[model samples]
Each structure stands twice: as structure tokens, then as C-alpha cells.
Target: MKNLVLGVNDAIYRACIGVAGLAIVIMALIIPWGVFSRYALGQGLGWPEPIAILLMVLFTFVGAAASYRAGAHMAVNALSDRLPPQVQPFLTLFVRLAMAAISLFMLVWGYKLCVATWNQYLSTLTWLRVGLSYAPIPLGGFITLLFVLEQLLYGDQHKRRVVDYECTEDSKEAV
Candidate 1:
């Protein structure tokens, strides 16, 4: 079950990153052509700026999805590391709960924001509605929450442990 969840998470992250990367590439090519058309050909591209901005927004949010799944987000481990050996389990539980709360908050807030803007259209890009702009927040947050839940529920202790050894001379020790 844990493996299946992780597999899904990895698939989502990779797909989002791939799409965002393609968006960036298309944006790069479009902008240069738009510039050339404006300056060299005396006619500006009608939608370059709008397209670029949209692609940039997509890149950031999609990249966030990937980061969350990979556990690459910035975090403070000071408190966890400072706890005594026996208290680590409790601390881990607390941290997971806090993360779950954050994810839920984002999900609710983003949904509200998206709903509020549903009727509005982007000024520069009339082709896009405002709801589309805010959609990524909830989507990314949900994916992040799922990833956190998987970790919280079934994290493997053996895989998480640190091993250290100092060799000592002994009669039975191999050279």
C-alpha cells in the first residue's frame, strides 16, 4: 500500500514537472519570436506577454507539486533533533499533524479564492478565467497532503535509521 502511494506520488510529480518544463521551453521560443516580430517586423505578437506570464505561473505551481512529493521543501528540524531519544516518536506525530493542518488550510483557502474569482477574467489574457489562475493552489496542496499522509501512516523505521560503526581490533576481527 505504501509503495503504491509512493508510486502514484512519484508519477504525479514527474508528470507535472515534465509539463512545466515543456511550457517553459515553449515560452522561451515564443517570447523571442514575439520580440522579433515587434521590433524587426513592426508588428507585435498579440498574446506574448499573456502567454509568458501564464506559462511562468504554471511552471512555479507545477514545480511546487514535484518538490512536495520529493520532500524537498524547506523545513525546520531544530526541535525534532533536540528532543531526547525517547520523545522522538511523539515529535514525529506532532510534526505530521502540523503538516496535515497546513495542507488542509491551503486546500480550503485556495478553493475559496478560486471560487471567488470564478466569474472574473484575467485582464491581460481574456482567454483565461480567474479561477484557472488560482486552481493550482488547491491542486498542489492536495497532492502535498496526500504525500504527507502516506509518510505519516506507514513510514519505515529501518530505512530511516542511521548506522555508524568504529572498527576495533579483536582476535576474530577480519583484517
Candidate 2:
């Protein structure tokens, strides 16, 4: 059962990484083309900016999920680390609960935003719906919620620890 859950988590992590990487690469190419078309061609494309922004949203939100799973997100562990070993569990639990609350907010409000803007169209790109612009917000929140649940149940970033081999002695030796 643990192996199955971990396998799913690993798959999600890899998918997030791949999506973020693809979004970044596409943004890189699009930005340059937008610049070239505007200055060199004297006819700026109308779609590039919107597309780039969407891609950035994709990269940021998905990348954040991946980072959180890997324990790469910035965290203030200094104080917690100094606490007595017995107190550490409580501290970690408190922090995770706080994180869960924030994730819930993002999920709720983000989805609200998406729904609110559902009828609206992008000014720059008429064909695109404005609701889609806010997709990353809810998506990222949901992804984070999944990770947080995993931690709350299993303790710590179990998926990434295994996926990244963070617990291996060799990694510590290198550091």
C-alpha cells in the first residue's frame, strides 16, 4: 500500500516537473519572438504576451508544488530545530496545519476567481477565456493540498525523499 501511494506521488512529481519545464521553455522562445516581432518586424503579435503570462502561471504554480514535495520551498526550521526532540513533533504538526489552512484558502478563493471570471474574455486575446488565466491558482493549491495530506499522514516529504534520494548517506557525504 505504501509503495502504491508513493508510486502515484512520484508520477505526479515527474509530471509537474515536465510540465513546468515545458512551460518555461515555451515562454523563453515566445518572449524572444515577441520582442523580435515588435522591434524588428514592426508588427507586434497580439497573442505572445498573453500566452507567455499563462505559461508563467503554469510554470510557477506547478513548479511550486514540485518544490514543496521536494522540501525545496523556503522554510524557517531554525527555531524548530532547536526545540527538544519531544517538542519537535508538535511544532511540525502545527506548521503543517498552518500550511494546510493556507492551501485551503488558495483553493477556495482561487476557484472562486476562476468561476467569477468564467464569462469574461481576455482583452488581448479574445478567443481565450479569462477564467483560464486563474487556473494555476486552484491547481497549485490542490497539488499542495495533496502533498500536505501526504505529509500529515506519513510524516515529512516522503515522496520526494524517495524520488530524490534525499535520505541516502551518499547525498549527505557530498554535502
Candidate 3:
């Protein structure tokens, strides 16, 4: 059962990484094309900037979830580290609970925001619904919530091979 859950998470994590990577790659191509078309070709394109912005949003939210699962998200542990050993577990629990709360907030409020804006469309990209632009928020929140639950149930996955590829590679090299 544990292996099944971890395997599922591993697939999800890989998908997140791929999505974020694709968004970045497309944005990189789109931005340069936009610049080149505007300056060199003497005709500005309307789609690139908005598309890039949307991709950035996707990258940010999705990448954030991936980072969290991998324990790569920014966290200042100075205060926690200085605390007594016995208090550390409590602090860890507190942090996880706090993350769960934040994830829930994002899921609920973001879905509300998306629904509220569903009827509207982006002015620059007439076919694209404004709500669609906000989809990543709830999606990312849900993904992160899954990861948090996994942590609460199974313990920290930071050392997992899927999450820490570099460490795995180093260990392989040592062997």
C-alpha cells in the first residue's frame, strides 16, 4: 500500500516537472519571437506576451508544488533549529498543519476566484477565458495538499529517490 501511494506520487511529481519545464521552454521561445517580431520584423504580435504571462503563472504554481514535495521550497529553519530537540517534532507538526491550512485556502479561494471570472475573457486573447488563467492555483493547491497528506501519513519524502535525484546519483557513484 505504501509503495502504491509513493509510486503514484512519483508519477505526479514527474508530470509536474514536465509541465513546468515545458511551460518555461515555450515561454523562452515565445518571448524571443515576440521581441524579434517587434523590433526586427517591425510588426508586434499580440499573442506572445499574454501567452508567456499565462505560462509563467502555470510554471510558478506548478513548480511550487513540485518544489514543496521535493523539500526545495524556501524555508528558514534558524529558529526551529535553535530550539530544543524535544520541541522539534512539535514544530514540524505545526509547520505541516500550517501548510495544510494554506493549501486548503488556496484550493477554496482560488476556485471561487476562477468561477467568479469564468464569464470574462482576456482582452488580448479573446478566445481564452480569464478563469482558465487561474486554473493553476487550485490545481497546484490540490497537488500540494496531496503531497502534504503523504508526508503526514508516511513521513518526510525528501530523501526519496524520486525527490532527490542528485543524492541518488551520488550514492550510485559511491557504489
- Please say which candidate is ahead in lDDT: 1 or 2: 2
Tens digit of per-residue lDDT, candidate 1, span 35-80 = 9999999998778987888788777767765665565767688988
Poorest 10 consecutive residues of model 2 by lDDT?
158-167
Taking all chains together, each candidate's TM-score versus the true structure is: 0.73, 0.87, 0.91
Stretches > 4 Å off in candidate 2? 158-175
Candidate 2, residue 152: Cα displacement in angstroms equals 1.1
Q: Which numbered prediction scores highest in lDDT against the true structure?
A: 3
Model 2, position 143: C-alpha lDDT score: 87
Any residue pairs clashing in model 2, and if so which? Answer: none
Superior candidate under TM-score, 1 versus 3: 3
**Candidate 2 Cα lDDT to native:** 0.86
Q: Name the TM-score of candidate 3.
A: 0.91
Candidate 1, residue 168: Cα displacement in angstroms equals 37
Which digits, one per residue and each the tens of the lDDT, describe model 2 over residues 83-163? 999999998899888888988888999999999999999999998889989999899998888888888877676444564
* Clash counts for the predictions, in order: 0, 0, 0
Candidate 3 lDDT tens digits, 113-159: 99999999999999999999999999999899989998998888977
lDDT of each: 0.74, 0.86, 0.92
| Rank list by TM-score | 3, 2, 1
